[model samples]
Target: MTLLPEFITENGEHIRLMLVDYFPRLVTAIVILIVGIYAIRVIKRIVQKIMVQRQFEPTLSKFLADIMIWALRILLFVVFISKLGVETSAFVAILGAGGLAIGLSLQGSMSNFAGGMLIIVFKPFRVGDTIEAQGVIGTVSEIQIFVTKLTTGNNQTIFIPNGALSNNTIINYSMAGTRRADLLFAVAYDADLKRTKEIIQSVLTSNNKVLKNPEPAVVVNDLTDNSVRLAIRPWATNADYGTMVSEVLESIKLELMQAGIETQPFVKESSKK
Candidate 1:
């Protein structure tokens, strides 16, 4: 069969197109897209594996992995769209607008994310630790994206927003291996200072849970108008602090009472330091 002349323009340009032009291009594009998606998935898996293998602090690792995945996907999408000869400037403009809207809506969440990053980097405390923050005392249960979870001594679970945590003062009691337990008592002027000191020492010494290295201390700190002020200080492990201190104080009061050493009344009487 004889072929007809190609379509010609007045400018002396001619065009001859293949019958498979549109379909072949479409198929090629589909294949590329498929391969690209597969690559992205593979990369994501690799990232996840690396993060897991490193055993990074879970909260921090997850955050980093998420950022990696997001950046990868966005870049891939942009590249694919550009391959189709699409106007990327318009795409970016639209994305910018959408991102702005989303950001406005999620400002608080983003603040929390920033806070979480700060916390992970600084490492003021970790999960399962005891801390006092924002005037709340609790054991850290979990550190998450938006908030930190804490379980109080009373078994009450509380969720503190990460931003607030980052801003507030945090006291990590667990960070210190030993904590001082300070107790005060008053005695009458007639009470023997020597006997009182001995009693306090006996009480702290009997508490085996208290740390021995610091050597529990007892001293006559002050003498008030009503009674002689005495101080008892002991060192105990952070874990056993509350129970040990409470028990020691209770024991001393009871022991002194049993020894016929009545607590000096807070009456208007002179005290001997």
Candidate 2:
């Protein structure tokens, strides 16, 4: 009983001595950790504000901000562990090994991450731009870290993976401030070419959306045996492209009909196919 009491008393004294020696360091580490967290938050906010002001991509900005916060937090953790007398090099080594294992296991995720980074850096297209890729045509709604969102003309939502998107051919239709609307209309072979051109020119000139500087082009695209193919090309801003095309097409059809211009009838020839 006496031996037990003596052992307990000695151990208690040793623990008290250790606490007295370590208490200041523990307190200091905690205080530093708290301050460091606040600093990191402030820094993150500043970075976000800068990104917003610079008109950076929202996804890229958020992703970079998160990375910055994590890096700072990791550094603060290392400092805290050092204050607690833990071996930081060993901890870092362990983290590296674990990260390698995770990286190998999630290889696809890493590829997507890399693809997303490449997209952000290269800037193939931006949100609100109309792009055709992977057999889908739509306007870009968002560029996320792992995927890109598209809103189609019919209001369909599409999610494309970043890796596949980066690898495939992306046709951006809105890169040019103005888009050329190419329209083809088939008229009867006997129709007067001069009168047809005049009517088409009238229709194009009256439309405000069509750019007058480049001048509208109405030319013979092809000489089909059954009909005369007229190609109509007009330049309009991206926003007005769809509406202007519809209007031009409708006006041409109505004007041609009113002038008694005949449309080519279906004449299936054996050599046509």
Scored by TM-score, the top model is 2
Query: If candidate 2 were superposed on the true structure by all CA atoms, what would the RMSD be?
Result: 4.3
Per-residue C-alpha lDDT of model 1 across residues 65-165, encoded as one tens digit per residue:
77887877787788767666667998889989999999999999999988887787788988888888877889998999889999998899999999999
Top-lDDT structure, candidate number: 2
For residue 25, give model 2's deviation from the true position in Å: 2.5
Misplaced by over 4 Å in model 2 are 1-8, 11-17, 265-273
lDDT of each: 0.78, 0.87
